[model samples]
Target: MSNLNSLQYFIPELFLIVAILVIIVVDLFLKKNKKIVSAYLAALTLVVTIFLAYQQYGYSPALLFKGMIVLDSFAIFFKIITALSTLIVIFISLPSFRTKAEYYVLLLIVTLGMFLMVEVNNLLMIIISMEMVGLISYVLVGFNKHDLKSSEASLKFMLYGATSTAVMAFGFSYIYGISGHLNLDVIQQSLIINQPQALPLFVAFMMVLAGLGYKIAMVPFHFWVPDVYEGAPTPITAFLSVGPKAAGLALLIRFLITLVAHPSAGNAANFIQNVSIHAPLLLAALAVATMTLGNLSALMQKNIKRMLGYSAIAHVGYMLMALVVFNNQGIIAVMFYIVVYLFMNFGAFCVVESLTDKLGSEKISAYTGLGYRAPFTAIAMAIFMFSLTGLPPFAGFIGKLYLFAAVINQSWYILALIGLLNSVISLYYYATVVKVMFLNRQENAPPLRVALYNKLLIGALLIPTLVLGLYWSPVINFTSRSIGFLFGK
Candidate 1:
């Protein structure tokens, strides 16, 4: 399609860019104490973006902007998820942090970048979008300028992020040199026709994976997660855990689909043989290492944010397991897990944010006697913890079931076994938090009360976590439809 014709399909992103500029101007005119107005405005922008993105659903996939971006069910679905996650982060920020217009503006920009990250069909667009998200994230991580740990975390994140970007760029240069093409579809066709040397292809891809891994906090690239999560403002940490991670997964899936044999080719047995490199085995190894390291490390953390940070990495491993199959079922499982994860993970962080506000500490010890001190809050937290652990009758359990079923159906027994064991290991730590809250109550602890707004928000997140457990057909059907891409039926 011509650039002018593409403008119709690009309406949502165009609206977002205008919204962000308007937010910056509005913030400039507001007094420092009145910055809360900007927060409300940001939330309203995201709500409108969500509706606009939803309207694009069910349209046949089409490439826009001279094939730099693709508008499809996959991209639209992730756009809605990213916008919703940011909207929730705004509410999560409202209760605790001093309202700052700049923070919300940065968040809006980050959301815009994520929308591009999932839709990019060219290498140039991919690097531009990833860096956009990365640069904005550095500012958000260190937004708490008064805290030394926050500053330190920002420095570490910046250093690592820069190194990974350089490595990925180097890899992309190699790909372009060999294929003589910048578009992913062209690159895939070139690689298949030329059949490049396996060693160089493997190394180049691995380098590119480094950058994607850093975004998702995959192990070996995960050194920055704990400190950053513990130091950043709680709401930003929550946003980092879910929003960008989902975007990274979307990018990974799209990249992999380009290289592997198409599902419609009717040669499932030779899927890996068709690819130039051993992507399946390499990804499986990363999945195992990521989950094991995250679970083992989380067992010893004292801070709630740090523990959850590691837990986030482990969940990435679970999602990666779905990718091992490289089929429609695996993609559907991934989409379903991401939707369920957004609610349960964000709900857990909200509880932690509320407790931190009340007690001025994020230490696990602060949770002592929470069962009696804050019964409603404690019960809601228990549900979140259980769901995250993938226990029965929770949305997370259903998510895991689909993922493991996808893996096992393809005869990846060892990968499935490792994932199962990791789930059991996760239970011990999750249950420990529950036990501390309910079983080891401190004597003479005073009763605590959560704010009405917080209680309602917690209830809002909790109901989905429980309701999806019992009846999840709506989400399952939505995700199953949303996995369609421009190149697939």
Candidate 2:
């Protein structure tokens, strides 16, 4: 599809752009609760955008913007992920950021960036979309200028993002030079037919991986994650944890599927140009390192936010484990994992965000005796903890089951074993939160009261976290259909 034809499929993104401009103008005139009004408008904008994105789901996948992007069920699936994550984050944000209308506006821009992140089909679009998201994220991380950590985090995040962008662009330049094209499919065909030399292609692949890997918190590229998560406002941390990360993964999967790997028979994937690249084996190692490091580091953290920060990395490792297979099984497992992760992670963060205001601390100790002091929140946190830990009867368990199943089915027993041990190790820290909440006694403690709206928010995220655990066939089926089109091509 050309630019003009792309507009019909591009309504959601365009609407988001128009909404950002309109809300900024609206914020100027409001005297009271400007942020509140802007937040509601932002919420409305996301709701409408989600509906528009859903409308795109039934259409056949088409290359849009003259082959710069593709409109497909795969992209639409991730669009929903980004939008739902953003929509909920807006509600979670309103409580703390009611004074800054611009805060909401910045969030809307990040949402726009995430939207572009999943739809990219050209190598140039990859850099452009990532830079757009990265720049705004740097600003969002430091939105609280009063806090020194926030400022420091913003600086580190910007530096890291800039370095990764340059490396990615450098790698992409090699690719474009060799292929003489910018569109991913065309570049892929060039690679297949011309068979570029091994050394340059290897360097380019790793460089590009480093860039995309940074977004998903892949190890060696993940140094910025903990600091950024801890320093950013809780709501922004929640958004960073899921929204942009999903976009990164979706983009990565598409990049690899389109450029690096090709269909091998009915259900296998392999390097398009060379078998010795061992991409799957390399990713498997990263997955192990990521999960082990994340779980071990999280065990040492006292701050709840920081703990969840490491936990997010571990979850990324789990998703990467599935990516090792790089087939329909792998894609299905990864997609389903992303969906469950969104709910469980948001619910956990929602509890932290709701409680940190009253407790004055995000430490695990702060939650001691919370089982009695704030039973609702404590119980909710415990459920999220169990889900995050991948316990049975929880969505996280189902997510992990699919992940491990995919690897085991491929006879990667050793990788699956390491993943299992990591899951067991994670139970300790996650259960630590549960233990502190239910068992530790706090004498003369006051009863905690969470705001009605925040409670509503928790419930909104909670239902899916629980429902998906016991009954998730519909979700799996949906993921299968979404990937069917992409893999079919």
lDDT, candidate 2, 1-489, per-residue tens:
778978988999999999999998988889874458888899999999999998888788789989998888999999999999989998998888887888888888988888888988899889989998999899989999999999999999999999999999999988787789999878877877887877787788889999999999988799999899999999999999999999999999987776567644234444664533668888999999999999999999999888999999999999999998888888899999999999999999999999997999988899999999988888888999999999989899999999999999988899999999999999999999999999998999989999999888898888999999999999999899898666675
| lDDT to native, each model | 0.88, 0.89
Top lDDT model: 2
Residue 285 lDDT in candidate 2: 93
lDDT for residue 56 in candidate 1, whole number 0-100: 97
Which lDDT value does model 1 have at 292? 94
lDDT of 2: 0.89
Q: Put down candidate 1 lDDT per residue, 1-489, tens digits, no spaces.
A: 779999999888899999999989988888878889999999999999999999999999888978888888989999999999999999988876546888888999999999999998899899999999999999999999999999999999999999999998988887887788888877877866777777677777888899899999998899999999999988999999999999999998887766555535322354546346767787889999999999999999999999999999999999888888777788889889998899999999999988897877899888988999999999999999999999979999999999999999989999999999999999998898899899988899888878988888889999999988899999999987887563366
Q: Where in model 2 is the C-alpha error above 4 Å? A: 263-269, 273-276
- Residue 63 deviation, candidate 1, in Å? 0.9
Q: In candidate 1, list every pair of residues with a backbone clash.
A: none
lDDT of 2 at 67: 94
TM-score of 2: 0.98
Worst 10-residue stretch by lDDT in candidate 2? 263-272
